[model samples]
Target chain A: MIDEIVAAPGAGRALLDDYLARYAPGARARGMVLEQVLVAPPVWLDDQSNTLTIRWSLANAGAWWGMRAVSGADSAVAAWWAEVDARAISRRRSFATAPEAIVRLCDV
Target chain B: MFRLTQLVTLADRAARDDLAAALRAVGRRARSLLVEPTLEGSFNGGDLLVHASFNAAGDRAAFELEAQALLGRPATASIDSVSYSSEADGREPGLRDGIYRVLLLSIEPGTDRDTVARFEAELLAMPRHIAAIRNWRLSRVEQAAGARAWTHVWEQEFADAGGLLDAYMLHPYHWAHIDRWFDPECPERIVDARLCHSFCRVDRSAISSGG
Candidate 1:
């Protein structure tokens, strides 16, 4: 679940929120801040290849600090970058998948 | 997340008896007691008459008797109020919808017989209750409709936890229940089993009953 969640766009918000909720004092000391939440539609680059993308941003130093405090600096940096890419990819995929999911939901 | 209720199947008499017993045992030892009745009404999908409660030591004695009678478990029991709740009641009832059966308990860590037993029991009972309600026959279609009306009620009293405040403002009962079952920290647990199998079997039921 954590893996998939991190792979999700706007996952940074969730992760940041969780960190603050569980470790607000540590978050404050680190300058963790959540700048925004972005949910993108599923994208389908091609019917054959089938790719996805998502996009999001953050404004607070705490966002990075929060990640470092919770996951450690090295892993935190990796997680932050992962969130950035995942958000963009998820958005692209959502645009591609939304119609299908909605159709499936309705048809089923 | 997909509603877990979709996987439920009705429990037989023997099963219900066993579940009742288990519920009764736990109810007997709770610290506080609260009963949320599942009124037979129509709203969300239709109402599923559920008598959920929280009971601490004061009400534990009676709760234990009832829950044990409902589920058949005999382990050391302790609990708080039963947060009795039902689907919303406003719309008409129908035969196409499913009902809900919920079981929430917080046993002391390391004290429970099998951590997942009670959780599974409650999860399994939902279908049984739905099946029982569906089996009842009413002579007149309208009369039967009316009879089914209160069986499942739908209400939107539950708040949506989206933004930060939304998460913070969640009712303590809801959070407590979630924490007990879903929280990563606590080994203690609460189980809520819902079944929408009926809805899929038939067409869309009235949404007035709480879904």
Candidate 2:
């Protein structure tokens, strides 16, 4: 599965570029093509933790590559994918209603 | 040199990339154009962050008009003016690649004057206790003719997203000392805090170089 992480928008873009940059050599070495398919802003779910989550998608990559990246079994791609699962797990707790509550109280 | 930071909420998902591209195309007239998406926080009904700087205030206003036209009625824009910033020394370079948090706040009614003063003081003094903050600023909104909702704005730039998460969000000082002011239970909740992220534009050339 493709892993996702939330970041501030600019940082998210830089990260996406960085990820592609870092993965390009290894991917080319393996003769695989990696293309970023989508880079969109987060859909703020009331149940979501990050208010602005940048969702990134890549095309022409397989599950094996994703698994390797997530598992951190290989040091080369470990740094990039290691935090994917961690961020997803942390986002699971849900602070969805917090923003609404704050807005109600402060009226901003 | 004036920079206008507008916190905007997209009318729909479709407007995301279109608006970003439009802002970037504003071109040489703009010193810098940064479009940041809010990943994990919200304020002022905004999810998209648009920051643009210009050499002249007139150019900045012209850009705003163009931006509003592109954004259309579906989006709402709030412009903030820097009231106090540490970057006046000119030593600060362009925004670093990291997780930047922009906080919009309004002190609750009936809050003691001293408490408000202390809250602002401690907020500025946060770097002394937490080391992850790379740069930060506090600004007050330049209210237009109508009523303004948020009065104060606080911005913090972290070394990275993890640094923001660990050093600020989960810090002991933040939890023990800072969190209380914003406690929902307290009638004097210091302010309604709206958190958003700021990012540097991606370096496409570096990505292509595989660096």
Candidate 3:
């Protein structure tokens, strides 16, 4: 899962921390291990949103689906996002797989 | 030439293969027949599709009568059938040995004509972004007589199964743009959820060879 966050000038760091602190535990419990967290520009003052690209990984498609079912059933996972939605201007989450696994994962 | 296509929902899922075989036998009486069970990625699409073409226009009625009679043997739940000539035939020479996909959908009743036109234009524009759609046709259903009042019959022939399941379905234009009309969550959605999204493996061109 990747999150594109559009926020006020310097609030991205706090928002990122808030997400990591609040959502990370639930995410890990649901079978996702935070592989990496990187904020573009590290520090930007001009006119640009500091996009947070957080990535996670699982065992395989089976584990990913298992995580989805578990996460879906767990209300805290969605509740956390609902609580945090007000802080960001716009937030979007996307699920993707590595290009090498596309043929096998997407069943193309 | 007349092409008669029916998206059928069987009362019993176990009898699908047998019913498909029986339908294939009935379809053979026509010039060409493609009776095959649809693979996954189907929303409200039926169990299988009965796609048959006739050389003479009058043969359509006779074939339909026979096929309709056979429907009672297995106790079909419902069927959405369309008989139409290729209204917008784009039989480009890209892929002959490919799969044929057909989508039957009804525009939400009472949608403004301009919005519906835009929806169709956006739908037709899909091939521009996704080149895998080898042969395509977007036709207004001449006669939509079935469980639902279908308005449009959009079909595409891809170079291969991947060209459909992957390239066509996953393309950004399909989900990001064209999908809004089909997605119930989107406010721009105009299509009803009961859509017949069915496809079959066809080594030959189902649209071009219908005549």
Clashes of each: 106, 10, 0
lDDT of 1 by residue, B22-90 (tens): 443454344322122232222122212222223233353454355435432233121211222223232
Q: Which is better, 2 or 3, measured by TM-score? A: 3
Query: Which model scores highest in DockQ?
Result: 3
Task: Kindly provide the TM-score obtained by chain B of candidate 1 when compared with the true chain B.
Answer: 0.21
lDDT of 2 at A95: 17
TM-score: model 3, chain A: 0.82
The candidate, 2 or 3, that scores higher on DockQ is 3
For candidate 1, report its TM-score.
Answer: 0.23
Tens-place lDDT per residue, model 2, A1-107, is 12244544334555446556775566545433443334443433334343223222222123323432333234544344444333333221111223454333222
Which of the numbered candidates is closest to the native, going by highest lDDT? 3
RMSD of 2: 19.8
Score every model by TM-score. Answer: 0.23, 0.52, 0.63
Can you list each candidate's DockQ?
0.04, 0.01, 0.07
Please give the distance, in angstroms, between residue B85's alpha carbon in candidate 1 and its true position after superposition: 4.4
C-alpha lDDT of residue B90 in model 3: 55
lDDT of 1 at A13: 48
